[model samples]
Target: MIQPLSMRGRHAVVLLVEDNEDHVFLTRASFEEAKLQIDMRHVDDGAKCLAFLRKQPPYEDAPSPDLVLLDIHMPRMDGYEVLDAIVKDDALRHLPVIVLTTSAEALDIERMYGMRCSSYIAKPLDFESFTKAVAQLAGYWLNLVVVPHRDG
Candidate 1:
């Protein structure tokens, strides 16, 4: 078992860009089950994800996320398009975006890495595996990694 590192008295803020409500539920539940304290914000599609990141209109008061967990397929825009936009913008480029999707295709992995995604995770099919995966992800990113602090 991996021990958690101190977060300097603050919790990690994670932005989840996914279209499926079930996935959203699973993600939140997994964190809760793992006893990880992460402040998660959700956006259903890539367009909304961009809006939240850019702090536009309704999302103007949204907090800048410490990390992003993005899904590959969605309405309005896909993950690839979102990744492209993030990479091109100087303000958003510094943020670490992890591609979390069901697709484990080599081509998809190569494409995401080529686009400069911080990580690519092939989501597991079973509930137990999914929970474990989420726990590991949180443990690594929020506890083990020393990410630079930035405010939006």
Candidate 2:
């Protein structure tokens, strides 16, 4: 088992599982704008995110992320499937998962909450609101929340 590193009052590492390049750029920019000193990793698909989390083969040197921002719609595997897998895995279940997707459907929200997502955020269609939302999310998760550091 891999142990989580102790953070010296620094922002936690965040894994962003998103498929759209535009959204990725915007999200990254928002994080920077938020002034949160996070070590961010972006995976284009849920499958790659899962592989990275498992530290399998090529991901042998991968670090366990403190939080995950998952997109509901993606190729290969959707965020719901990824969330299900994470919650089921003993080693990864404790890590927080936040649903950051464009889907605002009640069913999606309920299902994600049922699967134990820490939070569910609907993506804003407007660019300004999107930026603000991202910034707020960063502020809340990286600054307000006290997360557990797991070491094995």
Candidate 3:
């Protein structure tokens, strides 16, 4: 349901926090067919996600992402912790974050919403379906919605 608009606007940066390499690859592949230009970065864990957003040591020069795709379960820190941190941080709270996880439990979805995530999506098991879902999601959020500029 995406309207065909000029996809040449400012490149939207997306940070994907996923520990699974295969899921990361699938997301990358899905973006290949996007109608809008996007700059996607991948972090393996919640801790790294926070680090990337905070411009910490290794990620000091990392740009602030317009959107974030977060995974629930990760070593060191979980998505809940990252979400908590984001909500608490004055600099990062305004950024939109979408929860991407395998759990479709009502509690999980509710909890994510309670934490003020922009959206909650469960990963599809089928590759084709997964790709399609991601495409649709990307289309809706990136193409249809207006992304706000991040103030320094």
RMSD of each: 3.3, 3.2, 3.4
Q: Which ranges of candidate 3 are over 4 A from the true structure?
A: 1-8
TM-score of each: 0.94, 0.90, 0.90
Candidate 2, 9-121: lDDT as tens digits = 55577899999999899888888876768888989998999998988867778777888999999999999899999999998998889999989999999999999999999
Model 3: pairs clashing at backbone N, Cα or C within 3 Å: none
lDDT of 1 by residue, 30-137 (tens): 889999888899999999999999999789999998889999999999999999999999889988899999999999999999999999999998888999999989
Q: Residue 33: error of model 3 in Å?
A: 3.6
Ranking by lDDT: 1, 3, 2
**Evaluated with TM-score, which candidate comes out highest?**
1
Candidate 3 lands at a TM-score of: 0.90
Error of 1 at 1 (Å): 28
lDDT of 2: 0.85
lDDT of 3 by residue, 68-129 (tens): 99999889999999999999998899888999889999999999999999999999997778
lDDT of 2 at 68: 94
